[model samples]
Target chain A: MTVRVLLADDEHLIRGALAALLALEDDLVVVAEAATGPEALAMARAHRPDVAVLDLQMPGADGVTVATSIRDELPSCRTMIVTSHGRPGHLKRALAAGVRGFLPKTVSAQRLAELIRTVHAGNRYVDPELAAEAIAAGDSPLTAREAEVLECAADGAPVAEIARRTSLSPGTVRNYLSSAAAKLGAENRHTAVRLARSKGWV
Target chain B: MTVRVLLADDEHLIRGALAALLALEDDLVVVAEAATGPEALAMARAHRPDVAVLDLQMPGADGVTVATSIRDELPSCRTMIVTSHGRPGHLKRALAAGVRGFLPKTVSAQRLAELIRTVHAGNRYVDPELAAEAIAAGDSPLTAREAEVLECAADGAPVAEIARRTSLSPGTVRNYLSSAAAKLGAENRHTAVRLARSKGWV
Candidate 1:
């Protein structure tokens, strides 16, 4: 039986090309395509594709949000997250949202189709490297205090100012900055802040 | 004309499955498969496939290294990076290394094959969403000094310790923390570090 598939991504060129690519597969049928998260969710509910390939970041709702909706509304239809961003946090969140497969856009076409087939077949699929990194990193790295301090640091705020805002002593704020820097393996607060922002931890 | 392809990734299941998937395509042939970067480079040189799909992080020479070698040796073969990790830094580096296409592993099997065809046809392919985020975030957000300070913080080093290590005054370290907080729009140093680490900016 041909596996019904749905494609969701905001890029016109990518979406069209992906549709064309999927169409080439004899056992894979492109049932629908959506450009945004809401459209993706709506299309999935309407078309009921056996599997949905979703990009994480979308126009209205994000992929995670859509995945949650799909799980609630169409429990049988599996969701495979297809995204360009491979942030560990994003992967963790995707898993938590009940996505059966997590693949990054950098994957080869052959692997992608295989993953889709695997996920559609009801087997879990995760990038081994990402799974390892996610396991190693665990949850958020920053302590509550450190995360607060780092957020303040990202804005170029002074320790004294951060201390005043967060009701911590200036010395305490400095300590938090020091701790955060240590956690990120950064040499200074500025570098720590940049690293945190990129990871979407903050 | 049949498009010759080379596969490089460590996972046996994925590597083998991908080979099988691509082999089904009448116009595509898997000429070589390698589990490591060094092997991939050697295979690419040996087979000289029309396209080379490489994983970013491998046991020995990683995807970027293989891409560089492929670009230098096989100018006719278009290089496409296929990795599970979607770190912007990796993507930027892959492009810089002369890879014509960047595909995340999450793409459908059909799309992956299509990308190979598209890229081999002299077109470029990248996850559009990633492309946007990369454009938005640009390159390293922190200055060299800030990165140094942040790395120190990641180690849980105290401000005095960081200052001592970096030869900066305590006041300078504090200043850097504040600047990072401001840039990251974080309320505290901890939050700044978390944000920076998430973005891989540090």
Candidate 2:
């Protein structure tokens, strides 16, 4: 069976190049190209491609969010995240969101095609260097809730706004913020976000 | 006359896409593509393209270094910098380096082609938003020598080594560092470098 693929990247050149590269595979067909996360979602819904190759960063939504949306809307279609920065936290979140493959943008065209095939065949693929880095980076120190609040805070949300976004009480949000700050050895929420971001823990 | 061009960027997809875009122009031809700064220099020397479009960040040497080398090696080949980040300091440095064109990566394919033509015709091009930002950023406070010394220091070199590299006496290097630190109101050399970098002053 032919593998249908959707390519999503903010770089037009990259999207065009990936599409051109994949066109060479005998069993692969390029079905769509999207320039942003929202566009990817819309194209995915329209094309229902067998595999979605996504760059981890985009304008409207990130790769993880798009992956989650695909998993929810098109359960059979697999997702492969290709990012320039192989942040361990990103890999972890992508895995949790049920993405089937993760790779860095530095990957060669041949390897990219092979990974697409692997993911399309219902197998998982993770770049060896990125997997090793994730292992070396150790476990995430923030709990699920703590990480959630920190993500909201990282968006520059105030305590009350974070609480509203997270469906938590304002007091609970403050407690999580304080706990995250203490765990990261940060003096405040802003420093905590910066620290976590540097470690790829946020 | 047909305007020959060279495309240099670390991302293979971007290189390919830009080449494809430029191929659409009747008067423009892409003569070479490079994935690194050194590769860019080598290809420029080899192809002698009329215009060189480069990404700001690449391995080995950066866009500025590549542009400078191209100026020295192939004076007729005008250089244009296309960057994802439009930091005012980047624009300042690029202009100082005699780069003929500065653009953000968000520019459309049409605008990019037009800019290429504009630059190839021996005219200057600057992204409007970036130009506005550079205007607001005003002038860099560090003297030319001080900025040069601070750039070396940002690599974590001591004053003596910086002096050797910049062809200045050790005491002169120390005096420059002290003046820079005082001007930036930084407590130490490390803080001074950090502050200068954050402001795009160094």
lDDT of each: 0.81, 0.86
Candidate 2 residue lDDT tens string, A1-202: 8999999988764676567667878999999999999999999999999999998999999999999999999999999999877788889999998999998776677788898999999999998999988888778789999989998987456788888898999999999999998998876776687778866887
Give the TM-score of chain A, superposed on the true chain A, for all candidates in the order listed: 0.79, 0.83
**Regions of candidate 2 where Cα sits further than 4 Å from its true position:** A20-30, A142-195, B17-31, B108-114, B136-202
| Candidate that scores best on DockQ | 2
> Can you give the TM-score per candidate against the true fold?
0.52, 0.71
The residue-by-residue lDDT of candidate 1 on B31-123, one tens digit each, is: 999988899988998999999988777889988889999889989989988765467767787789988899776676678889999999999
Please give the distance, in angstroms, between residue A74's alpha carbon in candidate 1 and its true position after superposition: 4.9
- After TM-score superposition, the amount by which residue B148's alpha carbon in candidate 2 deviates from its true location, in angstroms, is 10
Candidate 1 local lDDT, A62-132, one digit each (tens): 99899999999999999988766567778888888899998766676666778889999999998887777
Q: What local lDDT score does residue B2 receive in model 1, on the 0 to 100 scale?
A: 97
lDDT of 2: 0.86
- Kindly report the docking quality category of candidate 1: incorrect
